[model samples]
Target: MPNQPKTPVKGFRIPVDLYDAALAKAQSEGRTLTDVVREALHRYIDAD
Candidate 1:
């Protein structure tokens, strides 16, 4: 069987200063902060 990630999710908060600019940018783009952060993290960690 293939390994799989655990589910039934949990979450934590980022320090406001860590991504405050990104949150503001997300608001300007009419995106939810969560959506913006999720996309950013996806690209970031997936990068070679």
Candidate 2:
């Protein structure tokens, strides 16, 4: 099957403390900040 095009990228500002915390956790876990945030958002939405 052909690959689908990815969604366009978007940017938003977050608090410095939140970014720092996500960066630290991502580094420790060997993952990107995007990965951490995506997982977090998925869990949050699924909790509804």
Taken over the whole model, the C-alpha lDDT of each candidate is 0.76, 0.87
Candidate 1 residue-wise lDDT, 1-48, digit = tens = 139665455588778786788778888998887677568789999996
Lowest-scoring 10 consecutive residues by lDDT in candidate 1?
1-10
Q: What overall lDDT, based on C-alpha atoms, would model 1 receive against the true structure?
A: 0.76
lDDT of 2 by residue, 1-48 (tens): 149577678899999998999899899999888778788999999999
Candidate 1, 48: how far from true, in Å? Answer: 2.8
Model 1 bad stretches (over 4 Å):
1-15
Report how far off residue 1 is in candidate 2 (Å): 17
The candidate scoring highest on TM-score is 2
Backbone clashes for every candidate come to: 0, 0
